[model samples]
Target: MNLALWIAAGLLAAVALAGGITKTFVPKEKLARANGGGWTATASVGFVKTLGVLEILAAVGLILPAVLGIAPALVPVTAVCWVLLMIGAMITHLRHNEAKFIVLNLFYLALAAFVAWGRLGPEPF
Candidate 1:
């Protein structure tokens, strides 16, 4: 369990950092291709940027508490929140005909769910 959590935390941190960096640097036009719906809505740039910020924060929350053994509960909370957000992202992709991103969203969502379950779900032999 410890190993799983640590690996997941690393993945989470790397993913968040990479995404945050991308959002912070990439031009909006380029983002459109990687994003859902080809970034049709003008608000998408802001939306994704904000989401990136949130993800980075959540990733930090997941690692800081547990890694430092300060407040471990926060890790599960962050995972839960990330799962919810990914669900919303999946919906957004479907609504916008951005099928490409849906798979990646689902992958992230599943990974988040795994983290949540590993942290909070019942033990299974």
Candidate 2:
């Protein structure tokens, strides 16, 4: 169970890190184009960058505390943060009529929720 949780956390971290880097460094026009336009069209660059920063922080929160065995309890807290972010993502996607992205958002939501539950339960780091 510990191994599984670590793997799940690692995967989530990697995805969040990648997302953060893209949103922070990539040009808005390119990101908008890549995301099918409708989404970023309604969002400001600052807002996107803010989300990116949150993602990067959450990614780090998920790993560092647990790995260092310092405040390992933060792992579940980070997972909860990811869950909230995914909920917001789902709402935003739905509002923009982006059904495709919502599915992925839901998947991420579930994964985050699982990590939250797992860490808070038997597999806590």
TM-score of each: 0.80, 0.95
- What lDDT, from 0 to 1, does candidate 2 have? 0.89
How far residue 110's Cα lies from its native spot in candidate 2, in Å, is 1.0
Error of 1 at 120 (Å): 1.5
TM-score of 2: 0.95
Kindly provide the TM-score of model 1 when superposed on the true structure, using C-alpha atoms.
Answer: 0.80
Across 89-117, the per-residue lDDT of candidate 2 in tens digits comes to 99999999999989998988888888899
Q: In model 2, where is the ten-residue run with the lowest total lDDT? A: 33-42
Give the total clashing residue pairs for model 2. 0
Can you list the residue pairs that collide in candidate 2? none
User: How displaced is residue 11 in candidate 2, in Å?
Assistant: 0.9
